[model samples]
Target: MDRTLLEGLFRHAVAQAQPALAIERHLPAPPKGRTVVIGAGKASAQMAQAFEKAWPGEISGLVVTRYGYRAECERIDIVEAAHPVPDAAGEVAAQRLLELVSGLSEDDLVVALISGGGSSLLPAPAQGLTLADEQAINRALLASGAPIGVMNLIRNQFSTIKGGRLAAAAAPARVATLVVSDVPGDDPALVASGPTLPLRGGRAEARRLAALYRLDLPEAAQRLLASEDNLPPEETDAVFANNSVATIASAALSLEAAAEMARGAGLEAAILSDSIEGEARDVAQVHAALAREIATRNRPFPKPVVLLSGGETTVTLRGTGRGGRNGEFLLSLAIALDGVDGVSALAGDTDGIDGSEDNAGAFVDGTTARRMREAGIDPQAALANNDAYGAFEAIGELFKTGPTGTNVNDFRAIVIR
Candidate 1:
């Protein structure tokens, strides 16, 4: 398989994972009373648009998504906000979303469109805790390379509308959550930090995670977590019992679609796993080794094979680098491959944003090293500084698909021919 063909196949898979189409298939019927839609995520806008198209009744309300990810809907309002960190815009949007569902009756319908990036995009800080406090802690969490679950656990405790609080606010309304799974295991509670389900962990766990990661959290956040009043949602048929959550799409399904495309192109395709998680660079090194062994000996599946995997990867910030997990993975893989022949790979986040960087991820071919050298970029220095974006930009090969309007996690494909 050539580099062009591999890129085409990867792009095809990404299109199939878009939220608008996926959300359409999972939408339920319109509620008996007013149908109010409220959600947060990178794909929230697209999800709302799909719901509006599918529903038969009057739909109104708002949802928040990452900047540049907004979609058009005549009845539903779309709000854009910052991601990976909470912003004032997100705080106001979150409060409005919660307010929309405040007086919903048992007959009312509250559709929560959940997806990746929602945790940061929807910020309703609890009483006595300012958005600045939440933002500070959020910044610390992102820099610490803590797992998404751990980070969200802390955020949920300090928020007025996360970890089942959204449902709690909706009182007697019948709530249904339509989520695009991005985290490993596709845990509904972890998806969008479980705005409708009962939260399990508490401040003790948050403090333990902070200690384990050595993160410097805000004093207000620390005290809030330590407070006895900080507790998870309680079980009740009215709120917890009536709320229904369903995963509309996930990384595993997306990987399967990609595998099918590869097979159609006459390449033997294998999906390694969908729940992969770890440091981005470390995972890339391991994947590179596997590809090398397979290419050299054909032990796994022989030549003309495409090894595919999907899942979110984390990066522990050790330098002032500007790249997402996909970029970091490609940098590490390039080093591991070390000019090896007959291997071409692409790693990228499905959401079209890698970390806070502009590009989703980078691609590497057999001659990627030579291309970097030709471009006069120091590949080793770039990797050390976490400057995958710079290195790939110099080579004119950075993957630039802006605002895919979806979030499943990372997509990686290694082709050996």
Candidate 2:
């Protein structure tokens, strides 16, 4: 249970979750006619490349991904856009994608590659709403501390392409969606707002979410919500519907792979939960307690145990700090596990980029507190500023993976001996 072994386990888990291998193996047969590939998400570009390799016939279309995640695709055009926030490029991509599917006949196939960040990558604002308005709304939502489910629910209400609307636009054509699910439950409707599915909920949920989050709706959005057209279901066919929605990869799957790897390395492994949610700092405290239990009392588990969990956590934006959710979670954990022995942990988003920062996440060994103490950095103060990335960077503890070209939410592993 040395530092190198613990770190290797974390890296192994991340490698198992990369989209190239995991996502490429889940392809369905290319349609008899033209196969029109369309997608949006952090991994859509990588997913598109996989589609080209697996398809038997001709394929052409577009898939938008977060900046720096684009892969080379001959027939399928790959577009890069902003994530966690919508941009004009995404707006254009959404319009073009809608156009691409609109002309497909029943004989054609619309292979929709979807994953996390699709909501922001494929943002085509509803009529009367501008990209700026959408951006403002998105900024507000991210800052509101709402869970992904609630945030996507609200997003679906404001977009013309989300919440199954994309599937509707490709009516008559057979549509199959291949997804790398980043959501807790892997619900088709919740992953990137289920672009290839139909909206099933009413506007009431969106209305309640806005009010609950104290979000100020623009006039255009408010007007649309009041209208009857809000979240109206679009017509779609059932051809190849049985296996149309397939989750090629998920956070739980990645975590299990990590746990197995850890066990093989002579460490007892425990997977806490893959659907953990709520505040990042709060979740870290709970994880810290579990680490301590394994290190000392061994009440729930014995020594030489590695605790693993996967799920998206939220930061309420209390301070103007720079970091993603994973970094924040590690900072909080480091504080809680301060001066504790034989406990080390790594928490990071499966996607290389975390939140608005470029770092994947941060890692903390048993000496994290000691290192911070020597540097005169207050873990508590850093946590308060939501500056986990800053603190970790100052101490060279930030984990940087650039872009793994996938998104399956967060991966957290703690090894205690």
The numbered model that scores best in TM-score is 1
Looking at model 2, which ten-residue stretch has the lowest summed lDDT?
A: 234-243
Model 2 regions lying over 4 Å from their true place? 22-25, 234-243
Worst 10 residues of 1 by lDDT: 230-239
**All models: lDDT?**
0.83, 0.83
- Encode model 1's per-residue lDDT on 1-417: one tens digit a residue: 266766776677677767767776777667779888888899888888888888877888899999889899999899999888889999999888878888778888888888999889988887778989988878888877777788788778888888898888897988888888899888878987888777667678877877898878778777776786656676443567767888988888888888888888899998899988888889988899889988899867888899999877787887786888899899888878867888989888888888888887878876786778789977888887888888898888788788788888888999998
RMSD to native for every prediction? 1.6, 2.0
The TM-score obtained by model 1 is 0.96
Off by over 4 Å in 1: 235-238
